[model samples]
Target chain A: MSNASTRNRGIPNPLAWIGAAALGLFGEIGRLAVFSARVKAAAFSPRWYIGQIWKQIVQIGFFSLPVVGMSAIFIGAALALNIYQGSGRFGAEQFVPNIVVLGITRELGATITALMLAGRVSAGISAEIGAMRVTEQIDALESLSASPYRYLYAPRFLAALIALPLLVLVADIIGVMGGWAVSVFGLGFDSTVYLRNTLDFVTRNDILTGLIKAVVFGAVIALMGCYQGDRSKAGATGVGRAATLSMVGAAVLVLASNYIMSTIFVEVGL
Target chain B: MTTPILSLQNVEKRFGKNHVLRGVTLDVAPGESLVVIGGSGSGKSVMLKNALGLMTPDSGKILFNGEDVTQAKGKTRARMRERVGMLFQSGALFDSLTVWENVAFRLVNSGVVSRAKAKDRAIETLSKVRLGSDVADLYPAEISGGMQKRVSLARSIISKPDLIFFDEPTTGLDPITADAINDLIIEQVRGLGAATVTITHDMASARKIADEVAMLFEGEIIWRGKASDVDNSGNPYVDQFVHGRAEGPIQPAL
Candidate 1:
């Protein structure tokens, strides 16, 4: 007797994720369109819109502090060690403190950290809202004379806009401290010279520029994640695609925006 | 007899060539219970959805209180919705919200009452459905199926709307529980004197709740008469559907 119990298993493709990403971007765009249409259809009160601003503060600001702070600290310490080693080869090990502050503030610490948080938090926002939309809860609200946008997106969008920049600011501080710790303890730099060098190298423009990036990154993360999630169709599968797409799309947009902003800053002699 | 509060004229709906409602027309009088009966995919649910504006009819005039509301939107649609309550087949109580919260959702959303007042109203509705206040705090998933149905009923009537829709109200329950639900629906509708449209395949439920019964087959109302005439409805489709006979005008899928 021959038993036929064959399992046809094939290796999964890594590029399959790109399809998922595309689906999410499409959903996000669709949601944005719907939102615009709905807003145009029903113009609610300005006070309601303002209340949404405060709701965003609660959703984005107070919620994301711990995660951004922790990431910044770790990134700062790693950067300090890497910079010290690189400078040591050039017999300019003392420049490690200046380089760490400049490098972290300009590129890695602020923009990268903000982008990462956008992937995690903003994606979550989209998935949650998207699920609600598919499930007819949004329709239920409309039936009961509730504005879905005012009730749903207003707070979420506001939260991301308000909270993400604060989170990036915290990340910036923690990253500088991380660099400080690595330079003083890991490398043989005197604590006083390291602190003085960090202070001297820092300009108002560097801080301002990073803050600007944080704000824009926050908006991009929110818009993509929310748009994707809210516009998601096909129930559970749609939601999954929206979440993955939100992260990837937001991340790419952050990098691209960073280049654009930096260029603008340079051109304007900031 | 009161004037008809809701009327659908030549209503039709299709989803990608699948004709769900084919020139369906019905009139619902104020304070009357109209039970729409049919087999699965007989367009009973679709008809109700169209009536509620959840799914718009392809071509028809839906009149609300003598006003043509076929293309209404925003506040107009919402205002019409306010005077309506719906009990979905799946209960559809917001999973994240507590029983009371789900019941009071409309009240909160409309800003018609304060949160405390809404909770009080929720409690009152729950009691009307014979559910205790203890169940108010529990989530929909935490309760028994029968209890969830009762909670859904409570949510449906919490606002005491002028019109209500029940989509298979007593489905997925034992006979005893089903009868009890049927009784509750009848009693609630009678007490409120509200117009109601109940869509169900369950003959027993239809018999218990309907003042008038309309049997839908092949995307249209095949037979409509007083509830008492359902047992002897002359239409073969109605007879086959009510009796659940496999051999009938409604062909079984392979």
Candidate 2:
């Protein structure tokens, strides 16, 4: 009997599958690390592509404002309502303003905004770069000695890095105002009291921590997008898969990193 | 007598169990256009990539201007690359940029010329390809496929590179447009005085642009001769390919 007929081999060997998965994960991680290192190395390299960087900065920073702001406002209002309802059960309704501000400043404002941007900006980056990859534009750049890292990754990475923090800042303000508006009118709480409580409860460190996370999230978003994109296979479906992977991967990293950063902040007495 | 513009010696490349380029050795002289004809998956693209220093051969050497560049890295590789240009199979124009911007890419990126002058030069090059000035402002997505190919051709020559590689110059064009591209390629090669390597299965294109034609089969250059001699080559594989016969050693995929 032939080996193909004799052996069923329907089930994959569990150990082999595990090993392959582990190797594949490590390979992906290694590739990403190498890509990041190159992005850093090209940081101060010549032919800075100042115009491209500026264009990206405007695309990433100014263009992303409204969506991030709108998301923040809605989340803020919802969080205010939730806290008001939950705290009311414990007769601690007065603490709603404080918790809302703290939540917005330290966590939700940054993480939610980053996640939203991951879907919007990161997906956009990946799709655009993936299209370029499938079209062989990246290889074209390499053959021209134009340095894809300097021309493509550097500009977009720097823009996202500079943009996300500004977006987060806008998010934080809009969020606090959202809570304030809900408390002042809808929830029938005093406007001045809510504002005073928000100011008193949130610290500079809280805002700074969120901003720092913004930077990390920004890097993750752009880096994953470019990495997935640069490695995309040729075709529409391949580029589409790359875009999906980039958005999903960047969002997961943002959440994971947010947790880690928050833990470090707590441990460090923030 | 002068050093060949590009040389590949015993170059090998593999993708896992599939060995693509198997000790391929070839050379192209300056002011020559060497068209590499091969069946699909014959590793012609990989061989081009290896010669261009876009991919490292697992072993052997690639020399440009008498300098071994197979292992060239950092500034060395960059310097070698600075003198080389390629037109990708898909034209590969940056979709975000307009036609003029695509043509002026090398000049603008190198900062050798101001953007204003680069655009001027871009229009001038576009005109060389018979592209109208109106096409210059349209994005690559806005242009027809053939126009995109012309724009890609223009971009490749914008830097006046010493060596140029065209990966399937006429793969997806109508016969008329393909012939026009072939003509344009011949003109450009002569006008620029650049060593050229074009990979294609398009026999008409091969015959038109090839000063010398090389046939890549089974990851090796099986036969090479003047373009005019391809039809009379006695090698079975060459005869089969040149004649596009169904009954030969080369099996057409069903």
Judged by whole-model lDDT over C-alpha atoms, candidate 1 comes out at: 0.80
How far residue A18's Cα lies from its native spot in candidate 2, in Å, is 1.3
Highest DockQ against the true fold, candidate: 2
RMSD of 1: 6.0
Measured against the true structure, the TM-scores of the candidates, in listed sequence, are 0.85, 0.97
Off by over 4 Å in 2: A1-8, A44-47
Off by over 4 Å in 1: A1-31, A34-63, A87-92, B1-3
Which one is best on TM-score?
Answer: 2
Every candidate's lDDT: 0.80, 0.90
TM-score of predicted structure 1: 0.85
Q: For residues B151-252, could you state the per-residue lDDT of candidate 2 as single tens digits?
A: 999998987889999999998999999999989988987999999999999998888888899999889999999988999988999999988999999989
